[model samples]
Target chain A: MSTSRLARGRAGTSWPRSELPEFSPRELVDEINAGVEQGLRVVAYFGAAEGSDIRLFLVLADDAQSEIAIGTARVEGKAFPSIAEACPQVQLFEREIVEQWELEAIGHPWSKPVRRGRSLLGAAPSASGSSPHLPAVTDFYRVEGAEVHEVGVGPVHASVIEPGHFRFQCHGETVFHLEIALGYQHRGIERALATGPDRRSLHYAETAAGDTTIGHATAYCEVVEALAGARVPARGAVLRGIMLELERLANHVGDLGALAGDVGFLPTASYCGRIRGDYLNLTAELCGSRFGRGFIRPGGCGFDVEATLREQLVERLERAFVDTRSAVELLWGSSSVMERFEATGVVPKQIAKDLGLKGPAARASGLTRDARHDHPSGIYRFHQIPVSSADTGDVFARAYVRWLEIQRSVAFLRDQLATLPDGAVRSTVGPLPEDALAVTLVEGWRGEICHVALTDPQGHFARYKIVDPSFHNWSAVAWTLRGGQISDFPLCNKSFNLSYCGHDL
Target chain B: MLDLFLARLHQKHRTLAFPGGPPPVLPERYRGLPVINEGRCEEGCTACAEACPTEAVLLSPRLGIDLGRCLFCSDCVEACPTDALSFGGDFRQAARNRDDLVVDEERAIRLATALDKKSRRLFGRSLKLRQVSAGGCNGCESDVNVLSTLVWDIGRFGINIVASPRHADGLIITGPVTENMRLALEKTYAAVAPPKIVIAVGACAISGGPFVGHPEAHDGAGSVVPVDLYVPGCPPHPLTILDGLLRLLGRIEEEPGKRAR
Candidate 1:
């Protein structure tokens, strides 16, 4: 892995292909073994490319993390050994690939269909109507018992959060296994991006996930910038960073409040909600809209922050920080709240890493991976904010990690404001390169947001694939649910808080 | 137990006296009701009609605003650019009849100027607000949250958002009034014992916003209801929102305040 040729070239180049070692299907496991021995952690396995009808899987190794083009492209027509036998992490991706791309993973036991009837690419049943739809990966978890009935919760919940169905097979209060079925809220955001829209394409991107407008927009801009070979100005980068941090802080505060409310801590919930509201108001003050909408454009921020307004925001944030700290401390001191969160829904560090969880979720599990720190983009490099990490991967640890993140974000904001430079806020980002393939990875509040953009010859988007942090972390949710009591579901769910719409999109 | 008692004392009584005294009014930029620029329309310019996304602005060749379809998006004012199309400062646009809702250009301009003069007479004020979500996408509701946040700090300006309409001096409504939420909106309004102001926050609440005339939808806050103030925009900027709120409190002066540094 250390000697791997992980070079990224501009638009069109085949030179790097010659530098890398090539392997057939039978040698795939051997190659993976070599990489693992050399300290490569496989991040994800993206299914085959559509229309190519070729069996291909993308392997994102640890060493290649810094490299923009990290994933290995494996063609299925060639002989390749299934890594599922060795790496259990590859099992989930392999299952998805089986249903989506219809590629068989040899030696993989849990290769059942995941989406069943909703799968567009899976093989359909014959006219005999013996089987109405193809079986999915969810069917494998069917429990057999006298009174072990399955309780299905949501494609739509009572809350404002997006849709996700959780099939809890429980005997009384204790849960046996929890199976999650998502994709109800998919609005074809990626597909929409593939087909170009005029100027309003970013508007569609903004709505990919309602709560994550800033994160999605920042990632989207990064992809377009990489593709167009455009460099955002220093000031613009700082502004973008501020906006991103603000979004992260607000969401974290709100989640903490909601988690507290779920555990019946009303005072903490109200206080946190009020504090979160304050942050949102600050966002509205800086930008014209709350939720930080329309703040990030292609080349820069939509508006510049005036000095007077910046000072006002700083004062407001100072008050908010004090209030938030008090509220959090109060909640932490409450024995009831602590009892509910302490050891509930623990995700071991090893399991977290193998699953490639990012953001606060991974950080809480002692994985020192932060896109802001590791893959420094925008003003992150300049600010030098310490990446918050904790060893306990429980609900309390996750909440604590977020609290620490809020402090860091406030400090980062002050630092950025102190060194705020004067320059043009925007530059004209011309059309994207035709043959270029660019990938952008950003540390959103939830986790990592990765966007891969490919353009047509006419400078229009040919394919744009957005992998939100939720996509990688949702599998961890099911794992977190295992062995946990039914009462702890909401707490566990809040600990991860993966976006349903984001994953669906 | 001692700490709990102390904590209870530390909690500020989150209640403000309103209506009995002067109501809390927001700042100048708060988006509230559609203030017709009778002066601008008096010149026979139909810029608002042309600029409206949902044709919420109805300016016939002779008459000015058909308040029935008018969404207070401020597009008319933005289109004027001449500073003639000014907000009327009166947010009570609700009416019992469609005819009463109609604003002739000349009458609207006169009313706006008169309201502006009256607001100038009172310098210090406050307003009690009750917010209702008719059929909003929740975007406007989020913005309303910002009003009380550290940045805008609408509370500092004496504007307090009350939980119940009975304790309110004005109604700050957001949404296009979806069919499901119609009853909720009406009930909320009915709960507010009158002399209460109704401030429609977004284009949706005013003229159904983007949801106006949506073939796939039925029911609008305006269709089943009446509005006093119409602040316009998809989600109007918080400043504009503040301005509309202030007008309801009679806090806004005849002229804009000196721009703060």
Candidate 2:
């Protein structure tokens, strides 16, 4: 395994063909375990279907080295050894493999369904002609005792948000354990993307986790562009960079406002809410859609940012940030708000690192990991946004980290727009390269959105694995609830604001 | 508290003065309805249709777009050789029926036909909806949630999204209902108090926008439950969603409706 060398690539660069580090299931598990011991985090571990075999791929992201290592193993039997039992971060990935391929992860601690529903595997179906069992029907981890009681919420929640079931094993107000059951929003996006760099491929990527449209879309376009060997023009890259940062500002500000709203802070909540819309509308000003749909195309962006449009974006960006600054500042100044936000949902640094949390959630937990800063690509490779982190690892830390990011993203957008580059907005992307695996990671507002596309012989996608930051952070949310008051669930949940579709997909 | 008041005072008014005052001002670049110029489309020009990811455009049969199926990406507009298809500045893209969501050259989008005499009378004054995101990507969910924000303030119309289905008069469903969610969606429908309406938000909820034929998903909310209103955008603008809800309640007069800020 030590002799098996691994090379690193930027976020969008393509690998014509990756030689997987040779290892059997057991050996591969041991290698990953060794990598973890050396501070290498698992970025993505997905099962790719090959000619009659499920080739499992694992990406080890070494933050210290600023490099990514790839490894793979072909499943030899119905049951593969579970790496999750040793490496906690690979737990969700292993579960996803079982659910998708119907193969057994023999020693997985709890081998319940991950987003359980229809099996995407080509393997022969069981006698029932349905999924082995219903989603969330499997036994949840129980805290059996006299005082322990269970509370189940959603698949359909009280508010206007995506669906996911949350079961809290509580002894009085404190949560003993919280088991999250999602897949109520699963639309089989992975299955849809198979054999597709088709028209719908970009569309599916854009809508995969909705709020992170720009993030997922950018990653998707990067993968496609890399496969096609297309390079976006300077102007186009700048515009994409602007849009990405604007998306960050909009979401980070919105999250801050929502965090305020959760705590019943009215003034800041009202103003920040409107200001968030102002940011969204600014996105509307750039490209037709607010959520930045149809913006980042395969070769480049679909729309161009003309001179007048640039001015409008700048004006709105400045005004909105000013308003947002004042409104959000109130949260920090107010003692009551700070009290609610601080120490409510504390995600310890160790737990965050163990769970492989990415984005602001990880940053707040003092992990100091960001895809933009860590795995630079496109404009990020040239100009960088300093990683924001907090030592608190609490609700306030999360909110404050967002506020920090909001300012930095604003500054980045301003800087990019001020020095507008020259060239066509879009480049002509050719057909994807045959039999290649393109892995891209874009820092979505939520966190690292990793997209791995393995093309079949004809250049169509054979297996597309999307690892939303939510997939990594959801378990961390459960961890945050440990010994915390159950009433603080909504506030804590909003603090993380993990995407359900991103996870469910 | 005084400082907070001062900050808000300086922030000025952000809410739109619409319907009663004037329609909400969408950005110039904002895409809305597909304004089809039949004359501009040259014969045998299937460029727009070919370019459309979801096949929202049909040139050979007719020059029209199925808004329900549209990702609203404006790719067709960009792809069209002529001015046959263009994304206009109309935020009112929601419709009452599946068929109505289809906009041909005529550009007619059917509004929610004012419920019924009894139903309208019951819900018109005040409507409470329980949003069920069956398989939502959360793009629509984000916009839907925006309606409750200060900018949209859907509460002004006496409309509120309550916590419980029992308290809800209608269910606002998003996402293309996945197979796993089908049972939960049905269960949600069953739980909602009778005389309830189901408003499908976003193209996903109306027609499974992107994941239409995916095996794990039943295309849109219509497959699992009857949809009363169809708001069609990849994720409809907050204004569009508000307009659909208002039209369902028969609140909008001519222009986009307004609230007394």
Candidate 3:
């Protein structure tokens, strides 16, 4: 039995690598499973290869206590007992570890490569037949029956969206299972980030999931700032919060519009498409880029808001929110939209809990999980956005929860921007402390975005693991499609709007 | 239904008057083409080149920049000690050839030329393109998708993004062309009928933008297929994308003195 207590940590903070509790592979599995049974959720579980062995790291979040427990287990061989069977949250993480390292998760059910075949640490094992391992080429769960058939959608979809493949096991119009195969968009971001926080690292974080650029970049910056022990100015912290909420407003509005489009409701659909750009334009108005690139950095914000620009931003934000309110108000007025939305895609609260879904998705399922509320950091500590939730766990609930958040975020931005803090926006960040591990969690529009960085002795990145919200909720998306109408796939998908690149990365 | 009509009316006709009217006024902070003041540079200073994440800045024979690889980030402009390079709002950043993507102090970007007369006749009035995001971060994909919204209303120009490659007259490719998506992109390109063209949108599709030099990525679309036009920007603005499409279709002429600021 491992008696050493796990190294306690707070989100968006750094701890020395030497301080982590060490456990055997079996002890690690048992400890994590016991924690999961006691209501802790797994935030990140990854491996960093050391010679022939692997150093497995785990980050478990206790939302009730606002604490994170990090521990490492040394796996001497290629095989370790799977924790996925007991704690379903690490199911994908275990599979990824197995693929990235050559370590096998013994007794893990349905182990498969998460991304296109290649080991993150070194060269992949050569296959028996000719040709190397192909991405999205794997055994899919099959339903055998006379009437059961399969329909496959592309790595190149009809719409102008990121590439991913989807296989639906169908019995005529009813879907038995939906397995999403991604990694067509893998750009080797994690591998590139290892060994340095070079100039290109921020760009990688900014584009990790381009739509969640602010969310991911803030997480990246927070982790770096934590590692270097840098404190951002009050003004910069407020600006980051404003940008994050604006991002939320943009995506939530866009999703509302997209949901309308999927339901064939044209008014809200058309209005939202432009309104989404309007919110994005506000970010563009602050920073040069519409996506908020080059805005957030390690020390603080790259740009600042003057009194004049602040007034202009306030005016534009007011107008955009008004338009957004009018446009979104129509979605609820129409019975046709409501009927289509109310019961379309339902994920039970228990299932959502078991899956460890985050952000609005979990909130829609009656789970009161929000990083801002649970693990408050930076400006979020000073200002609080009340967690908005819905109990239905359907398309309507998801959409409604977004609407609630939209209103809340608009209010928050209005209040925060008016009481702008006067201070220098940026500070010089010192060199990172040698041999540190930092974890950051952000409440992105889709869900929780977790970024874990482990530095070597020289303070360069040894392993940079990014766990996008889509990684957790993609399974929920699949669950939503179970016994669902195949035609409703597009509608259900719009309801969640999970990112393929975020998951694939 | 009345409420829907009222909401529609409230949303109003928000489309931009571009190419027909004055070019839309972009915000001041918008970073378009980089203007290099060659005189301001120190004798052997390579600050701009060193600051660029994608090696877009070339300091050899004076300062030249590769727009195809530029993310339009503030890094270079901020890093310049002599104030040599500043981003000017000149949104016409599409080029007909890959070589034209690299611009120096003296010359502006060679805006994309129209398709040859025959191909122009084929796709001028009705160019249906199928967009494939090979390894896009969704920035390019989302911006391209914005073109079809009421604000841009790209279909008003008789262009649309069709649902199938078979029905498309061309392919608008975005991304760094990851190895996994290369085969699928090729198959989609082949599915299009003859006389089809390929347009690479954003820096990623043109020159791998931020993901440059990654082993999994093929750098750009040109490696897998020929690119007829290169639209520059990390994710080129909707106007930038629209400008490229119209330029290639010969719908809009390249006005010498007109620049959007």
lDDT string for model 3 (A1-505, tens) is 3343778778988899888889988888887887777788999999996667799999999898888989899987788889687677789999999988877999898788887745776774542212235456788999999999999998888899888888999999999999988878888888888867998999999999999999999999999999999999999999999999999999999999999999999889999999999999999988888999888988889999999999999999999998999999998998999999998889999999899898888999999999999998889998999999999999999999999999999999999999999998888899888889999988989878899999988888989999999999988888999999999999898899999889877
Clashing pairs for predicted structure model 3, backbone only? none
Which runs in model 2 stand beyond 4 Å of their true positions?
Answer: A1-4, A123-132, B59-61, B254-261
Top-down lDDT ranking: 3, 2, 1
Q: Show the lowest summed lDDT stretch of 10 residues, model 1 chain A.
A: A9-18
Ranked by DockQ from best down, the candidates are: 2, 3, 1
Residue B198 Cα positional deviation in candidate 1, in Å, after optimal superposition = 20
The TM-score-based order of candidates, best leading, equals: 3, 2, 1
Q: Model 1: residues >4 Å from true position, as ranges?
A: A1-65, A71-140, B1-261
DockQ of each: 0.06, 0.72, 0.70
Residue-level lDDT tens digits of model 2 in A349-395: 98888888999999999999998888877798899899999988999
Q: Candidate 3, residues B49-87: lDDT per residue as tens digits?
A: 888999999887769899999999969889999888999
- For candidate 3, the lDDT comes to 0.89
Q: How does model 1 do on interface RMSD, in angstroms?
A: 9.1
Per-residue lDDT of candidate 1, residues A382-437 (tens digit): 76789899898999989989989999999998888777889977787877765455
Distance from true position, residue B231, model 3, in Å? 0.2
Candidate 1, true inter-chain contacts retained: 0.01
Instruction: TM-score each candidate.
Output: 0.70, 0.96, 0.98
Give TM-scores of the second chain, every candidate. 0.57, 0.93, 0.96
List each model's interface RMSD: 9.1, 2.1, 2.2
